[model samples]
Target: MDESNSRSHTEEIPEFVGPYKIEGPLGVGGMGRVYSARHKVLNIPVAIKVFFRDVNEKPASAKRFIQEARLAASIEHINLVRVMECGNDQDDHPYYVMEKMSSSILLEMKKNGNYSEREAIDIGESVARGMSVAHHHSIIHRDLKPDNIMVSVDGLYKVGDLGLAKLQDIENTSPGLTMTKTGLGTPHFMSPEQALDAAHADARADIFSLGASLYFMVTGKKPFEDEGVQAIINENYEKGGPDPGGLNSDLSAGFCQLVKKCMAYKPEERYQTMENVHQELIDLRHRFHDSVKPIHFDTCFDLAGTKKEEIERLMEQHAKAASDKPKKEPVNKLYIVIIVALLILLLFLLKYIAL
Candidate 1:
């Protein structure tokens, strides 16, 4: 569920949904309200998303809601939220139970405005891993924003909220759920193709969204900041957002390049699969740990005059020079000295015999 949807309301909360006792409201989405709940028998904490009866009455909404639960529950990945069960209440309102997350990436961003480049990469990688699994299962997560990514108490990032997910295999059969040129997904994080036609968006679309999310994580700003939703969508479709490195000079060139590739205007230009994105993020994490250092505020002020390109070039040269340096061979000075002494002793003995 989206944390941004948390709002005070006058509606009475349900005491129980199926076998789980509803504790409190977690957040609300377009189709339903998420509540923190516990299993009556096991006392295990869980999150239950109860579909609004009015919305559930609609055939399209009902199918989409149930599909979301089924799709999420089918995939069993550590980085993806696990769905325990789904059923209808006495009032015929549909609800699905999932493992309750401690928090979300959205909450983390709210508490901490921006994340370090490393932190952003870690989050991106986790989400990519989850998306990779979904894509493998022919599921396209149209909405891959921070609000949909949850973080557990153990610091594990889990991808959730597949309410807008597109199933490639069943899309043709379910034309009602097929979003056409209307453009689904968050404007700021959606890909150009998705903005044009969400129904046609493939795995690369999710890659673009993930990239945009990473951009937001590191820069503390939306990829495309516009006055309105349509303008934001236009910016994403016509012109890509500004460079992440420019927004946050602390970001490394490699990391910025990764984001740029992910946010490519054309789907073909973006990473072909979530696996590719995951691998690149893994590589970036390794590079970050091996050589990259987080730029501090003091360091930024110290090198205020230097351009990012110059710093990157210098670092590249330094790394290259270090790698290209030749190793020195060992020398035996004692052996050389011994040989010289023997030669001198032989010469002196010959001279004395001659005398």
Candidate 2:
């Protein structure tokens, strides 16, 4: 069972978690509860992710939680949320501080339906760019989803929540938690390899996830969605991916093809590196440079009219002018030719008269 969602903040809300004071609850997940906090002296706002009591009760889970913090802290990328620090409270629960984002991409998605082609591609590009850095360091974000991606007020998209991330090197594994053949990660976005065996799941698994996430961004729907987690996992293992273009007809062939390549069932068939996905998105953006638009509208248009007659009169005049604008007289080539000929004859006559 996914404990992150089941478990609530068991411990009483403390005024402070380490040096940071808790402002409020951000959200709860399968692993732990996240809180909006601020540094005592610095007064800097940060997000503090703390493991639940049940997770902390187990040594393996505690170590894994801390490991997630360290792994995230190690990776430095603008597209990724920065881990500021990690610490333990008096209760022995593990928690880590991350740079707080103004809002999450998931929240934005809920507010606004599907993202535009350019917006979706841009978000995908940023995520792939961050994942490329993680892959370079042998880290794979097993649970890459819209909910895990954060968007800042300044329009910067970043990858966050590395609880399910796996480090490539086995020797660097956390003390208690061992990377077993057990499958881990969200069922809907999981790759075949990840579903079959998480231990062996590699960078390709993340590629599949990124593709799935991209599909969701453009279509406002999950590729493989079912009532049960097992059902979704089974579908991902047996069936082909849902056509992104089918849901969003505006999507181009290149966009659909890129998505299909990413969501390929076989890991070998999918993109081998995050860099490849990133490059493809870059090219896609270039292909539609002229049509690329701002991710969000900058200005709002007020439609209220102060004077009813003034508005109606102006609209009527505009419509009348627009209707008449294209009514052009057809030019007569014969008349033009005759006029030129007559002018030439008159010039000759004038010359004859002068002579």
Candidate 3:
């Protein structure tokens, strides 16, 4: 058995939850406990998230859990975790089954230390692709952290755990479902606007969280750190974190700029859509790893606060430098002919003298 899916001796493992047999507890979250389970009839491995009895007693929590299932199940993207089924258990608690993942990004990070710049870019791109689809459907993933990104056995990175997602078209029918309270999401990764009012968060909010998560992946440290939760939340709200490149000097300037743009203080300053974020990551990959050419002017221009005059000046200098570069002169045909003639004459002279 994989160490990640090891049975938890602390919690009692249920023999069955609906039609699935619980093999062991995968992990516990704020609203539910996930378990490694198998379908009773098909015998296929799956993950079942069963809500706590207290959560089921609360209408808001129950509604949110069901929404998570419905929203995730409706989307079909390779980069998003697939929801198999959702129903209630014998104990009257809500439960949802999803495809079992090999491990989460958080677990992988802990096991393999911090990811390199290239690895972080790959993970960020996959997440952006998945989130872009969700955004198109008018879903805002209010919570996006390494813990919510799962890695499959085949090494595909998938975005999971959408319990806190905000659907634009959906109404908050439950009395307490409105996220008017402050500090609604994970403090370290939440955007400033989201920390203030999660109900109004949009695609840009998810971009901010993705930037924070990428910062952690490269630097091995959370964007905001504090002794108290409220202090961290305050830091995220009042003051933005340091540049990711400053933490990890090995990261490329373009990548650092991309991350900084994503974590911009205001939503308007950040990338407007997940598709834009994905495209930036793609450009970063080419600029940092694949291409031997200089960074694109438009890429630098896209970064917030980058001056147009400076970019144009730099591009002009690059062009001038290329034009001024000295080229290798071709071998002189006359010189080669003279040398060959001299060699032939010397050979003839030596042969005649010997005779």
- Candidate 1 displacement at residue 60 in angstroms: 1.1
Residue pairs in candidate 2 whose N, alpha carbon or C atoms collide under 3 angstroms: 4-29, 4-30, 4-31, 5-30
Top model by TM-score, which number? 1
- List TM-scores for all candidates, in order: 0.79, 0.78, 0.77
Against the true structure, candidate 2 has what lDDT?
Answer: 0.83
Clashes of each: 0, 4, 0
Better of 1 and 2 by TM-score: 1
The positional error of residue 139 in candidate 2, measured at the CA in angstroms, is 0.3
- Model 1 gets an lDDT of 0.84
Candidate 2 segments exceeding 4 Å error: 1-6, 171-176, 227-230, 237-239, 290-355
Compute the lDDT of residue 111 as modeled in candidate 1: 97
lDDT of 3 by residue, 235-291 (tens): 655765458888888888888888888888888888899999999999988877654
Worst 10 residues of 3 by lDDT: 2-11
Rank the models by lDDT, top first.
1, 3, 2
